[model samples]
Target: MSPEEAPARRRGRPTGSRAGAPETREAILAAARSEFAARGYAKASIRGIARTAGVDPALVHHHFGTKEKLFGAALEFTFAPALVVPEILEGGPEGVGERLARRFLSTWEVPEVRERLIAVMRSALTEDAAAAMLREFVSRELLLRIAAQLDVPEPHLRAELAASHMVGMAVLRYVLQVEPLASADPEELVGLVAPALQRYLTER
Candidate 1:
Protein backbone atom coordinates (compact mmCIF):
# COMPACT_ATOMS: atom_id res chain seq x y z
CA MET A 1 0.00 0.00 0.00
CA SER A 2 1.08 3.59 -0.65
CA PRO A 3 2.33 5.65 2.34
CA GLU A 4 -0.70 7.97 2.17
CA GLU A 5 -3.12 5.02 2.15
CA ALA A 6 -1.24 3.36 5.05
CA PRO A 7 -1.48 6.50 7.27
CA ALA A 8 -5.23 6.81 6.52
CA ARG A 9 -5.75 3.13 7.33
CA ARG A 10 -3.86 3.43 10.63
CA ARG A 11 -5.87 6.52 11.57
CA GLY A 12 -9.09 4.57 11.00
CA ARG A 13 -8.48 2.65 14.22
CA PRO A 14 -7.73 4.11 17.66
CA THR A 15 -4.24 5.41 18.04
CA GLY A 16 -1.70 3.90 20.49
CA SER A 17 -1.51 0.23 21.44
CA ARG A 18 -4.49 -2.06 20.86
CA ALA A 19 -4.59 -2.67 24.65
CA GLY A 20 -6.48 0.59 25.26
CA ALA A 21 -9.69 -1.09 26.37
CA PRO A 22 -9.41 0.26 29.91
CA GLU A 23 -8.82 3.78 28.69
CA THR A 24 -11.69 3.45 26.24
CA ARG A 25 -13.97 2.21 29.00
CA GLU A 26 -13.03 5.15 31.23
CA ALA A 27 -13.64 7.57 28.40
CA ILE A 28 -17.05 6.07 27.70
CA LEU A 29 -17.94 6.32 31.40
CA ALA A 30 -16.83 9.94 31.59
CA ALA A 31 -18.83 10.74 28.52
CA ALA A 32 -21.78 8.76 29.79
CA ARG A 33 -21.73 10.73 33.03
CA SER A 34 -21.89 14.02 31.15
CA GLU A 35 -24.59 12.82 28.79
CA PHE A 36 -26.70 11.34 31.55
CA ALA A 37 -26.27 14.47 33.60
CA ALA A 38 -27.32 16.69 30.75
CA ARG A 39 -30.05 14.58 29.16
CA GLY A 40 -30.91 12.26 32.05
CA TYR A 41 -31.56 8.53 31.82
CA ALA A 42 -34.71 8.85 29.79
CA LYS A 43 -33.39 11.16 27.12
CA ALA A 44 -29.74 10.22 27.17
CA SER A 45 -28.76 8.24 24.06
CA ILE A 46 -25.91 5.79 23.85
CA ARG A 47 -24.97 7.11 20.42
CA GLY A 48 -24.52 10.56 21.93
CA ILE A 49 -22.19 9.28 24.64
CA ALA A 50 -20.17 7.38 22.06
CA ARG A 51 -19.86 10.50 19.94
CA THR A 52 -18.77 12.51 22.95
CA ALA A 53 -16.25 9.85 23.89
CA GLY A 54 -14.81 9.64 20.35
CA VAL A 55 -15.48 5.94 20.21
CA ASP A 56 -17.69 3.68 18.17
CA PRO A 57 -21.20 3.17 19.49
CA ALA A 58 -20.54 -0.54 19.32
CA LEU A 59 -17.70 -0.07 21.80
CA VAL A 60 -20.10 1.53 24.24
CA HIS A 61 -22.45 -1.41 23.80
CA HIS A 62 -19.56 -3.80 24.29
CA HIS A 63 -18.41 -2.10 27.47
CA PHE A 64 -21.65 -1.24 29.26
CA GLY A 65 -24.06 -3.73 27.60
CA THR A 66 -26.97 -1.27 27.58
CA LYS A 67 -27.97 2.29 28.38
CA GLU A 68 -29.66 1.30 31.63
CA LYS A 69 -26.59 -0.56 32.84
CA LEU A 70 -24.42 2.36 31.79
CA PHE A 71 -26.67 4.73 33.67
CA GLY A 72 -26.46 2.53 36.78
CA ALA A 73 -22.69 2.47 36.63
CA ALA A 74 -22.53 6.21 36.15
CA LEU A 75 -24.89 6.75 39.06
CA GLU A 76 -22.90 4.37 41.24
CA PHE A 77 -19.69 6.16 40.39
CA THR A 78 -21.24 9.53 41.06
CA PHE A 79 -23.27 9.20 44.27
CA ALA A 80 -22.48 5.91 46.05
CA PRO A 81 -25.17 6.94 48.56
CA ALA A 82 -26.61 3.43 48.81
CA LEU A 83 -23.28 1.96 49.85
CA VAL A 84 -22.80 3.28 53.40
CA VAL A 85 -26.36 3.75 54.61
CA PRO A 86 -27.02 0.11 55.48
CA GLU A 87 -23.89 -0.08 57.55
CA ILE A 88 -24.88 3.04 59.45
CA LEU A 89 -28.31 1.59 60.20
CA GLU A 90 -26.72 -1.68 61.28
CA GLY A 91 -24.56 0.10 63.84
CA GLY A 92 -27.52 0.23 66.29
CA PRO A 93 -30.72 2.24 66.38
CA GLU A 94 -29.51 4.72 68.95
CA GLY A 95 -26.70 6.22 66.89
CA VAL A 96 -28.58 6.00 63.61
CA GLY A 97 -29.24 9.74 63.42
CA GLU A 98 -25.69 10.88 63.95
CA ARG A 99 -24.37 8.15 61.73
CA LEU A 100 -26.79 9.04 58.94
CA ALA A 101 -25.89 12.71 59.16
CA ARG A 102 -22.18 11.98 59.17
CA ARG A 103 -22.48 9.73 56.16
CA PHE A 104 -24.62 12.21 54.25
CA LEU A 105 -22.33 15.13 54.93
CA SER A 106 -19.20 13.16 54.11
CA THR A 107 -20.65 11.84 50.86
CA TRP A 108 -21.77 15.27 49.72
CA GLU A 109 -18.36 16.72 50.45
CA VAL A 110 -17.01 14.77 47.53
CA PRO A 111 -17.23 16.76 44.29
CA GLU A 112 -18.53 13.87 42.21
CA VAL A 113 -21.34 13.17 44.65
CA ARG A 114 -22.29 16.81 44.61
CA GLU A 115 -22.40 16.80 40.83
CA ARG A 116 -24.32 13.55 40.69
CA LEU A 117 -26.83 14.83 43.19
CA ILE A 118 -27.37 17.96 41.17
CA ALA A 119 -27.83 15.99 37.98
CA VAL A 120 -30.30 13.62 39.58
CA MET A 121 -32.17 16.50 41.14
CA ARG A 122 -32.47 18.30 37.82
CA SER A 123 -33.59 15.15 36.06
CA ALA A 124 -36.09 14.37 38.78
CA LEU A 125 -37.56 17.81 38.37
CA THR A 126 -37.73 17.78 34.59
CA GLU A 127 -38.26 14.23 33.45
CA ASP A 128 -40.95 11.79 34.53
CA ALA A 129 -38.81 8.76 33.82
CA ALA A 130 -35.83 10.15 35.66
CA ALA A 131 -38.03 10.97 38.62
CA ALA A 132 -39.41 7.44 38.62
CA MET A 133 -35.93 5.97 38.48
CA LEU A 134 -34.82 8.10 41.42
CA ARG A 135 -37.90 7.22 43.45
CA GLU A 136 -37.48 3.52 42.73
CA PHE A 137 -33.86 3.54 43.84
CA VAL A 138 -34.63 5.46 47.02
CA SER A 139 -37.67 3.40 47.95
CA ARG A 140 -36.46 -0.03 46.98
CA GLU A 141 -32.86 0.15 48.11
CA LEU A 142 -32.48 2.89 50.66
CA LEU A 143 -35.72 3.49 52.56
CA LEU A 144 -37.05 -0.07 52.58
CA ARG A 145 -33.85 -1.38 54.11
CA ILE A 146 -33.90 1.21 56.87
CA ALA A 147 -37.64 0.88 57.42
CA ALA A 148 -37.38 -2.87 57.93
CA GLN A 149 -34.74 -2.32 60.60
CA LEU A 150 -36.62 0.37 62.53
CA ASP A 151 -39.68 -0.01 64.80
CA VAL A 152 -41.66 2.96 63.48
CA PRO A 153 -45.37 2.36 62.93
CA GLU A 154 -45.40 4.08 59.56
CA PRO A 155 -41.99 3.00 58.51
CA HIS A 156 -42.48 3.73 54.84
CA LEU A 157 -43.65 7.27 55.43
CA ARG A 158 -40.93 7.86 57.99
CA ALA A 159 -38.26 6.48 55.70
CA GLU A 160 -39.57 8.64 52.87
CA LEU A 161 -39.55 11.73 55.04
CA ALA A 162 -36.01 10.99 56.10
CA ALA A 163 -35.03 10.67 52.46
CA SER A 164 -36.69 13.97 51.69
CA HIS A 165 -34.77 15.67 54.46
CA MET A 166 -31.47 14.35 53.18
CA VAL A 167 -32.31 15.07 49.53
CA GLY A 168 -33.54 18.54 50.43
CA MET A 169 -30.39 19.32 52.34
CA ALA A 170 -28.37 18.10 49.38
CA VAL A 171 -30.36 20.31 47.03
CA LEU A 172 -29.83 23.34 49.25
CA ARG A 173 -26.19 22.83 50.03
CA TYR A 174 -24.85 21.34 46.81
CA VAL A 175 -27.14 22.43 44.00
CA LEU A 176 -28.45 25.74 45.23
CA GLN A 177 -25.12 26.54 46.87
CA VAL A 178 -26.94 28.33 49.64
CA GLU A 179 -24.79 30.35 51.94
CA PRO A 180 -23.62 29.29 55.39
CA LEU A 181 -25.37 25.97 54.79
CA ALA A 182 -23.03 24.98 51.99
CA SER A 183 -19.93 26.10 53.82
CA ALA A 184 -20.90 24.68 57.19
CA ASP A 185 -18.48 22.18 58.65
CA PRO A 186 -19.51 18.51 58.36
CA GLU A 187 -19.48 17.87 62.11
CA GLU A 188 -21.50 20.98 62.82
CA LEU A 189 -24.05 20.13 60.15
CA VAL A 190 -24.34 16.59 61.49
CA GLY A 191 -24.91 17.91 64.99
CA LEU A 192 -27.69 20.14 63.74
CA VAL A 193 -29.27 17.57 61.42
CA ALA A 194 -28.85 14.15 63.07
CA PRO A 195 -31.59 14.66 65.64
CA ALA A 196 -34.10 15.27 62.88
CA LEU A 197 -32.96 12.20 60.99
CA GLN A 198 -32.96 10.13 64.17
CA ARG A 199 -36.48 11.25 64.98
CA TYR A 200 -37.63 10.29 61.53
CA LEU A 201 -36.07 6.88 61.83
CA THR A 202 -36.98 6.07 65.43
CA GLU A 203 -40.07 8.12 66.31
CA ARG A 204 -43.48 6.45 66.43
Candidate 2:
Protein backbone atom coordinates (compact mmCIF):
# COMPACT_ATOMS: atom_id res chain seq x y z
CA MET A 1 0.00 0.00 0.00
CA SER A 2 1.19 3.53 -0.83
CA PRO A 3 2.07 5.79 2.15
CA GLU A 4 -0.60 8.33 1.12
CA GLU A 5 -3.13 5.48 0.86
CA ALA A 6 -2.49 4.27 4.40
CA PRO A 7 -5.67 4.22 6.45
CA ALA A 8 -6.03 7.11 8.85
CA ARG A 9 -5.12 6.08 12.36
CA ARG A 10 -8.12 5.54 14.57
CA ARG A 11 -8.12 7.96 17.45
CA GLY A 12 -8.65 7.03 21.12
CA ARG A 13 -8.19 3.57 22.67
CA PRO A 14 -8.91 0.71 20.27
CA THR A 15 -10.85 -1.51 22.65
CA GLY A 16 -11.53 0.70 25.70
CA SER A 17 -9.83 0.38 29.05
CA ARG A 18 -9.88 -2.99 30.75
CA ALA A 19 -12.82 -3.30 33.15
CA GLY A 20 -12.21 -2.45 36.83
CA ALA A 21 -8.87 -0.71 36.32
CA PRO A 22 -8.55 2.06 38.91
CA GLU A 23 -6.09 4.26 37.00
CA THR A 24 -8.13 4.06 33.79
CA ARG A 25 -11.29 4.73 35.76
CA GLU A 26 -9.76 7.81 37.34
CA ALA A 27 -8.64 9.12 33.95
CA ILE A 28 -12.17 8.73 32.63
CA LEU A 29 -13.55 10.56 35.66
CA ALA A 30 -11.08 13.40 35.23
CA ALA A 31 -12.06 13.72 31.59
CA ALA A 32 -15.72 13.60 32.53
CA ARG A 33 -15.32 16.50 34.96
CA SER A 34 -13.51 18.60 32.38
CA GLU A 35 -16.16 17.95 29.76
CA PHE A 36 -18.95 18.64 32.24
CA ALA A 37 -17.34 21.81 33.50
CA ALA A 38 -16.76 23.15 30.01
CA ARG A 39 -19.97 22.01 28.30
CA GLY A 40 -22.42 21.64 31.18
CA TYR A 41 -24.29 18.46 32.01
CA ALA A 42 -27.00 18.87 29.41
CA LYS A 43 -24.66 19.52 26.51
CA ALA A 44 -21.74 17.28 27.43
CA SER A 45 -21.88 13.86 25.79
CA ILE A 46 -20.38 10.45 26.47
CA ARG A 47 -18.70 10.33 23.07
CA GLY A 48 -17.13 13.74 23.54
CA ILE A 49 -15.86 12.82 27.00
CA ALA A 50 -14.44 9.59 25.68
CA ARG A 51 -12.63 11.43 22.93
CA THR A 52 -11.18 13.82 25.43
CA ALA A 53 -10.02 10.99 27.67
CA GLY A 54 -8.51 9.00 24.79
CA VAL A 55 -10.80 6.06 25.54
CA ASP A 56 -13.50 4.29 23.59
CA PRO A 57 -17.01 5.47 24.41
CA ALA A 58 -17.82 1.95 25.61
CA LEU A 59 -15.29 2.45 28.38
CA VAL A 60 -17.22 5.43 29.64
CA HIS A 61 -20.45 3.43 29.64
CA HIS A 62 -18.70 0.62 31.44
CA HIS A 63 -17.45 2.96 34.16
CA PHE A 64 -20.45 5.21 34.75
CA GLY A 65 -23.38 3.58 32.93
CA THR A 66 -25.53 6.72 32.53
CA LYS A 67 -25.01 10.43 32.04
CA GLU A 68 -26.64 11.25 35.36
CA LYS A 69 -24.42 8.80 37.19
CA LEU A 70 -21.38 10.17 35.40
CA PHE A 71 -22.29 13.69 36.40
CA GLY A 72 -22.68 12.62 40.01
CA ALA A 73 -19.26 10.97 39.95
CA ALA A 74 -17.60 13.93 38.25
CA LEU A 75 -19.10 16.46 40.62
CA GLU A 76 -18.81 14.63 43.91
CA PHE A 77 -20.87 17.44 45.40
CA THR A 78 -23.36 15.98 47.86
CA PHE A 79 -25.02 19.34 48.39
CA ALA A 80 -25.98 19.82 44.75
CA PRO A 81 -29.77 19.86 44.23
CA ALA A 82 -29.54 18.15 40.84
CA LEU A 83 -30.59 14.79 42.28
CA VAL A 84 -33.78 15.77 44.18
CA VAL A 85 -34.77 18.82 42.17
CA PRO A 86 -36.68 16.68 39.70
CA GLU A 87 -38.69 15.10 42.47
CA ILE A 88 -39.58 18.57 43.68
CA LEU A 89 -40.66 19.39 40.13
CA GLU A 90 -42.98 16.39 39.94
CA GLY A 91 -45.65 18.14 42.03
CA GLY A 92 -46.19 20.48 39.08
CA PRO A 93 -45.31 24.13 38.46
CA GLU A 94 -48.01 25.91 40.40
CA GLY A 95 -46.06 25.90 43.64
CA VAL A 96 -42.54 25.49 42.25
CA GLY A 97 -41.26 28.55 44.01
CA GLU A 98 -42.44 27.43 47.42
CA ARG A 99 -41.24 23.90 46.84
CA LEU A 100 -37.92 25.06 45.45
CA ALA A 101 -37.33 27.48 48.26
CA ARG A 102 -38.18 24.91 50.90
CA ARG A 103 -36.06 22.31 49.19
CA PHE A 104 -33.06 24.62 48.84
CA LEU A 105 -33.29 25.57 52.51
CA SER A 106 -33.72 21.99 53.63
CA THR A 107 -30.74 20.82 51.60
CA TRP A 108 -28.44 23.26 53.30
CA GLU A 109 -29.66 22.04 56.64
CA VAL A 110 -28.27 18.55 56.17
CA PRO A 111 -25.42 18.06 58.63
CA GLU A 112 -22.97 16.13 56.46
CA VAL A 113 -23.82 17.92 53.25
CA ARG A 114 -23.64 21.22 55.09
CA GLU A 115 -20.13 20.53 56.31
CA ARG A 116 -18.95 19.56 52.83
CA LEU A 117 -20.68 22.56 51.28
CA ILE A 118 -18.96 24.85 53.74
CA ALA A 119 -15.60 23.40 52.74
CA VAL A 120 -16.34 23.79 49.04
CA MET A 121 -17.66 27.31 49.57
CA ARG A 122 -14.59 28.24 51.58
CA SER A 123 -12.34 26.90 48.83
CA ALA A 124 -14.27 28.77 46.18
CA LEU A 125 -14.11 31.94 48.21
CA THR A 126 -10.37 31.71 48.63
CA GLU A 127 -9.25 30.26 45.28
CA ASP A 128 -9.98 31.88 41.95
CA ALA A 129 -9.76 28.67 39.96
CA ALA A 130 -12.00 26.74 42.31
CA ALA A 131 -14.52 29.57 42.31
CA ALA A 132 -14.71 29.55 38.51
CA MET A 133 -15.31 25.80 38.38
CA LEU A 134 -17.92 26.06 41.14
CA ARG A 135 -19.61 28.90 39.30
CA GLU A 136 -19.76 26.96 36.02
CA PHE A 137 -21.04 23.81 37.74
CA VAL A 138 -23.82 25.75 39.47
CA SER A 139 -24.84 27.67 36.37
CA ARG A 140 -24.78 24.84 33.85
CA GLU A 141 -25.65 21.79 35.91
CA LEU A 142 -28.08 23.14 38.49
CA LEU A 143 -29.48 26.51 37.47
CA LEU A 144 -29.75 25.80 33.75
CA ARG A 145 -31.48 22.51 34.37
CA ILE A 146 -34.08 24.21 36.51
CA ALA A 147 -34.43 27.05 34.05
CA ALA A 148 -34.92 24.78 31.05
CA GLN A 149 -37.91 23.15 32.76
CA LEU A 150 -39.83 26.41 33.02
CA ASP A 151 -41.93 27.35 30.00
CA VAL A 152 -40.93 30.97 30.26
CA PRO A 153 -39.36 33.57 28.02
CA GLU A 154 -35.63 34.08 28.60
CA PRO A 155 -35.27 30.84 30.51
CA HIS A 156 -31.57 31.37 31.14
CA LEU A 157 -32.10 34.79 32.68
CA ARG A 158 -35.04 33.57 34.73
CA ALA A 159 -33.08 30.62 36.06
CA GLU A 160 -30.15 32.82 36.93
CA LEU A 161 -32.33 35.39 38.70
CA ALA A 162 -34.17 32.75 40.68
CA ALA A 163 -30.91 31.06 41.62
CA SER A 164 -29.38 34.37 42.63
CA HIS A 165 -32.21 34.94 45.04
CA MET A 166 -31.93 31.46 46.51
CA VAL A 167 -28.14 31.57 46.82
CA GLY A 168 -28.28 35.00 48.39
CA MET A 169 -30.87 33.80 50.86
CA ALA A 170 -28.74 30.78 51.74
CA VAL A 171 -25.67 32.88 52.33
CA LEU A 172 -27.50 35.43 54.45
CA ARG A 173 -29.60 33.01 56.45
CA TYR A 174 -27.25 30.08 56.79
CA VAL A 175 -23.74 31.34 56.21
CA LEU A 176 -23.72 34.90 57.50
CA GLN A 177 -26.59 34.42 59.94
CA VAL A 178 -28.18 37.75 59.17
CA GLU A 179 -30.86 38.22 61.82
CA PRO A 180 -34.57 38.05 61.13
CA LEU A 181 -33.91 36.06 57.97
CA ALA A 182 -31.45 33.90 59.87
CA SER A 183 -33.84 33.29 62.73
CA ALA A 184 -37.04 33.09 60.68
CA ASP A 185 -38.88 29.76 60.31
CA PRO A 186 -38.39 27.94 57.03
CA GLU A 187 -42.12 28.11 56.24
CA GLU A 188 -42.25 31.80 57.02
CA LEU A 189 -39.22 32.47 54.89
CA VAL A 190 -40.70 30.42 52.07
CA GLY A 191 -43.89 32.44 52.30
CA LEU A 192 -41.91 35.67 52.14
CA VAL A 193 -39.62 34.56 49.31
CA ALA A 194 -41.78 32.30 47.17
CA PRO A 195 -43.74 35.05 45.47
CA ALA A 196 -40.65 36.69 44.03
CA LEU A 197 -39.26 33.31 43.04
CA GLN A 198 -42.59 32.36 41.49
CA ARG A 199 -42.59 35.56 39.51
CA TYR A 200 -39.14 34.81 38.20
CA LEU A 201 -40.00 31.19 37.50
CA THR A 202 -43.40 31.46 35.84
CA GLU A 203 -43.89 34.99 34.69
CA ARG A 204 -42.83 36.40 31.33
Candidate 3:
Protein backbone atom coordinates (compact mmCIF):
# COMPACT_ATOMS: atom_id res chain seq x y z
CA MET A 1 0.00 0.00 0.00
CA SER A 2 1.11 3.58 -0.53
CA PRO A 3 1.99 5.79 2.44
CA GLU A 4 -1.29 7.71 2.14
CA GLU A 5 -3.28 4.49 2.00
CA ALA A 6 -1.49 3.07 5.02
CA PRO A 7 -3.15 5.51 7.40
CA ALA A 8 -6.58 4.66 6.03
CA ARG A 9 -5.92 0.95 6.43
CA ARG A 10 -4.66 1.44 9.95
CA ARG A 11 -7.88 3.21 10.79
CA GLY A 12 -9.84 0.24 9.34
CA ARG A 13 -10.85 2.02 6.18
CA PRO A 14 -10.60 0.38 2.79
CA THR A 15 -8.21 2.04 0.36
CA GLY A 16 -9.14 3.14 -3.13
CA SER A 17 -8.83 6.27 -5.22
CA ARG A 18 -12.53 6.21 -6.20
CA ALA A 19 -14.30 9.50 -5.49
CA GLY A 20 -16.49 8.17 -2.70
CA ALA A 21 -15.82 5.80 0.13
CA PRO A 22 -12.71 4.02 1.28
CA GLU A 23 -11.95 0.46 0.21
CA THR A 24 -14.89 -1.24 1.92
CA ARG A 25 -17.51 1.25 0.85
CA GLU A 26 -16.22 1.20 -2.69
CA ALA A 27 -16.34 -2.56 -2.59
CA ILE A 28 -19.94 -2.49 -1.44
CA LEU A 29 -20.81 0.02 -4.13
CA ALA A 30 -19.12 -2.02 -6.80
CA ALA A 31 -20.97 -5.07 -5.62
CA ALA A 32 -24.22 -3.15 -5.55
CA ARG A 33 -23.73 -1.93 -9.08
CA SER A 34 -22.99 -5.37 -10.39
CA GLU A 35 -25.89 -6.88 -8.52
CA PHE A 36 -28.23 -4.19 -9.67
CA ALA A 37 -27.08 -4.62 -13.22
CA ALA A 38 -27.35 -8.37 -13.22
CA ARG A 39 -30.40 -8.87 -11.01
CA GLY A 40 -32.33 -5.67 -11.63
CA TYR A 41 -33.49 -3.37 -8.89
CA ALA A 42 -36.61 -5.37 -8.17
CA LYS A 43 -34.75 -8.61 -7.49
CA ALA A 44 -31.45 -7.31 -6.13
CA SER A 45 -31.07 -7.70 -2.40
CA ILE A 46 -28.84 -6.26 0.25
CA ARG A 47 -27.83 -9.77 1.21
CA GLY A 48 -26.80 -10.53 -2.34
CA ILE A 49 -24.76 -7.36 -2.58
CA ALA A 50 -23.19 -8.00 0.79
CA ARG A 51 -22.30 -11.49 -0.26
CA THR A 52 -20.64 -10.19 -3.36
CA ALA A 53 -18.74 -7.59 -1.39
CA GLY A 54 -17.76 -10.19 1.26
CA VAL A 55 -19.34 -8.04 3.92
CA ASP A 56 -22.22 -8.64 6.27
CA PRO A 57 -25.69 -7.45 5.25
CA ALA A 58 -25.81 -5.28 8.33
CA LEU A 59 -22.58 -3.64 7.25
CA VAL A 60 -24.22 -2.71 3.99
CA HIS A 61 -27.16 -1.18 5.85
CA HIS A 62 -24.83 0.62 8.21
CA HIS A 63 -23.02 2.21 5.32
CA PHE A 64 -26.04 3.09 3.24
CA GLY A 65 -28.95 3.29 5.71
CA THR A 66 -31.66 1.97 3.37
CA LYS A 67 -31.87 0.18 0.04
CA GLU A 68 -33.25 3.26 -1.68
CA LYS A 69 -30.46 5.34 -0.24
CA LEU A 70 -27.91 2.70 -1.19
CA PHE A 71 -29.01 2.49 -4.81
CA GLY A 72 -29.28 6.27 -4.98
CA ALA A 73 -25.80 6.71 -3.53
CA ALA A 74 -24.34 4.14 -5.89
CA LEU A 75 -25.97 5.88 -8.85
CA GLU A 76 -24.77 9.24 -7.60
CA PHE A 77 -21.14 8.10 -7.71
CA THR A 78 -21.49 6.47 -11.12
CA PHE A 79 -23.32 9.55 -12.41
CA ALA A 80 -20.75 11.89 -10.79
CA PRO A 81 -23.47 14.15 -9.43
CA ALA A 82 -21.00 16.10 -7.34
CA LEU A 83 -18.97 17.01 -10.40
CA VAL A 84 -21.94 17.60 -12.68
CA VAL A 85 -24.50 19.38 -10.47
CA PRO A 86 -22.50 22.51 -9.80
CA GLU A 87 -21.56 22.81 -13.45
CA ILE A 88 -25.25 22.66 -14.38
CA LEU A 89 -26.20 25.18 -11.70
CA GLU A 90 -23.62 27.75 -12.66
CA GLY A 91 -24.19 30.55 -15.28
CA GLY A 92 -27.77 30.98 -14.09
CA PRO A 93 -30.80 29.88 -16.14
CA GLU A 94 -29.28 31.01 -19.43
CA GLY A 95 -28.12 28.14 -21.62
CA VAL A 96 -28.71 25.75 -18.73
CA GLY A 97 -30.19 23.25 -21.15
CA GLU A 98 -26.94 22.89 -23.04
CA ARG A 99 -25.07 22.48 -19.80
CA LEU A 100 -27.53 19.91 -18.48
CA ALA A 101 -27.55 18.05 -21.75
CA ARG A 102 -23.80 18.01 -21.97
CA ARG A 103 -23.30 16.94 -18.40
CA PHE A 104 -26.10 14.37 -18.49
CA LEU A 105 -24.84 12.77 -21.68
CA SER A 106 -21.32 12.85 -20.33
CA THR A 107 -22.37 10.41 -17.62
CA TRP A 108 -22.95 7.72 -20.22
CA GLU A 109 -19.64 8.37 -21.94
CA VAL A 110 -17.95 6.04 -19.49
CA PRO A 111 -17.94 2.35 -20.37
CA GLU A 112 -18.74 1.02 -16.91
CA VAL A 113 -21.44 3.52 -16.10
CA ARG A 114 -23.09 3.04 -19.46
CA GLU A 115 -23.15 -0.73 -19.15
CA ARG A 116 -24.70 -0.69 -15.71
CA LEU A 117 -27.14 2.02 -16.65
CA ILE A 118 -28.42 -0.06 -19.56
CA ALA A 119 -29.24 -3.00 -17.35
CA VAL A 120 -30.85 -0.74 -14.79
CA MET A 121 -32.89 0.93 -17.48
CA ARG A 122 -34.05 -2.43 -18.74
CA SER A 123 -35.11 -3.34 -15.24
CA ALA A 124 -37.03 -0.14 -14.91
CA LEU A 125 -38.92 -0.94 -18.08
CA THR A 126 -39.86 -4.48 -17.15
CA GLU A 127 -40.33 -4.20 -13.43
CA ASP A 128 -42.68 -1.95 -11.49
CA ALA A 129 -40.48 -1.77 -8.39
CA ALA A 130 -37.45 -1.01 -10.49
CA ALA A 131 -39.38 1.68 -12.35
CA ALA A 132 -40.48 3.33 -9.14
CA MET A 133 -36.97 3.28 -7.74
CA LEU A 134 -35.51 4.85 -10.86
CA ARG A 135 -38.29 7.42 -11.20
CA GLU A 136 -37.87 8.49 -7.61
CA PHE A 137 -34.11 8.56 -7.72
CA VAL A 138 -33.75 10.50 -10.96
CA SER A 139 -36.50 12.95 -10.08
CA ARG A 140 -35.34 13.49 -6.53
CA GLU A 141 -31.68 13.65 -7.28
CA LEU A 142 -31.25 15.25 -10.69
CA LEU A 143 -34.37 16.63 -12.36
CA LEU A 144 -36.33 18.10 -9.46
CA ARG A 145 -33.20 19.52 -7.91
CA ILE A 146 -32.18 21.27 -11.12
CA ALA A 147 -35.65 22.61 -11.86
CA ALA A 148 -36.14 23.90 -8.34
CA GLN A 149 -32.83 25.69 -8.45
CA LEU A 150 -34.05 27.59 -11.50
CA ASP A 151 -37.19 28.73 -9.66
CA VAL A 152 -39.45 27.44 -12.37
CA PRO A 153 -43.26 27.25 -12.29
CA GLU A 154 -44.54 23.68 -12.15
CA PRO A 155 -41.04 22.55 -11.34
CA HIS A 156 -42.11 18.93 -11.19
CA LEU A 157 -43.64 18.96 -14.64
CA ARG A 158 -40.71 20.89 -16.03
CA ALA A 159 -38.31 18.44 -14.48
CA GLU A 160 -40.19 15.52 -16.01
CA LEU A 161 -40.15 17.11 -19.42
CA ALA A 162 -36.43 17.68 -19.22
CA ALA A 163 -35.94 14.17 -17.94
CA SER A 164 -38.12 12.80 -20.73
CA HIS A 165 -35.99 14.48 -23.33
CA MET A 166 -32.77 13.32 -21.75
CA VAL A 167 -34.07 9.83 -21.12
CA GLY A 168 -35.38 9.49 -24.63
CA MET A 169 -32.00 10.44 -25.96
CA ALA A 170 -30.33 7.95 -23.68
CA VAL A 171 -32.68 5.16 -24.74
CA LEU A 172 -32.04 5.77 -28.41
CA ARG A 173 -28.37 6.61 -28.23
CA TYR A 174 -27.20 4.24 -25.55
CA VAL A 175 -29.83 1.63 -24.78
CA LEU A 176 -31.60 0.96 -28.08
CA GLN A 177 -28.57 2.02 -30.13
CA VAL A 178 -30.77 3.48 -32.86
CA GLU A 179 -29.11 4.45 -36.12
CA PRO A 180 -28.08 8.05 -36.81
CA LEU A 181 -28.57 9.06 -33.22
CA ALA A 182 -26.34 6.27 -31.94
CA SER A 183 -23.67 7.17 -34.44
CA ALA A 184 -24.07 10.92 -34.14
CA ASP A 185 -21.36 13.10 -32.69
CA PRO A 186 -21.72 14.08 -29.04
CA GLU A 187 -21.81 17.84 -29.72
CA GLU A 188 -24.29 17.30 -32.53
CA LEU A 189 -26.55 15.35 -30.23
CA VAL A 190 -26.23 18.01 -27.56
CA GLY A 191 -27.22 20.74 -29.99
CA LEU A 192 -30.17 18.71 -31.23
CA VAL A 193 -31.46 18.01 -27.72
CA ALA A 194 -30.69 21.18 -25.77
CA PRO A 195 -33.43 23.39 -27.12
CA ALA A 196 -36.21 21.10 -25.93
CA LEU A 197 -34.69 20.88 -22.49
CA GLN A 198 -34.29 24.66 -22.34
CA ARG A 199 -37.93 25.25 -23.11
CA TYR A 200 -38.98 22.68 -20.56
CA LEU A 201 -37.25 24.43 -17.72
CA THR A 202 -37.14 28.05 -18.81
CA GLU A 203 -40.31 28.64 -20.84
CA ARG A 204 -43.30 27.22 -18.97
Best by lDDT: 1
- Candidate 2 residue spans exceeding 4 A from truth: 1-75
Q: Arrange candidates by TM-score, highest first: which order?
A: 1, 3, 2
Alpha carbon deviation, residue 143, candidate 3 (Å): 3.7
lDDT of 3 at 35: 89
TM-score of each: 0.82, 0.61, 0.74
lDDT (tens digit, per residue) of candidate 1 on 1-204: 678557645766453232256888889988988887888777889999988988878778888898877876676666566667777888888979998888888887888767777777787788776677667777777777778888888988987888789888888888887998988888998999899999998878
Better of 1 and 3 by TM-score: 1
Q: Residues 70-183, candidate 2: write the lDDT tens digits.
A: 765655644445557656766778998899888887887776555545555555576565566667777767766776677889987887898789878877877798998888
Where model 1 places Cα greater than 4 Å from the true spot, the runs are 1-23, 39-43, 65-69
Question: Global lDDT of each model?
Answer: 0.79, 0.72, 0.77
lDDT assessment of candidate 3: 0.77
lDDT of 3 by residue, 1-204 (tens): 678778755754342233244787888989998988888877889999988987767678878988777887776665564346645766777898898888888788878878877877877788876678777777667765665676678877887778777878889989888998898888888898889888877785
TM-score of 1: 0.82
Q: Could you say which candidate leads in TM-score?
A: 1
The lowest-lDDT stretch of 10 consecutive residues in candidate 1 is: 11-20
Q: What is the Å distance of residue 29 in model 1 from its true position?
A: 2.1
Itemize residue pairs with steric clashes in candidate 1.
none
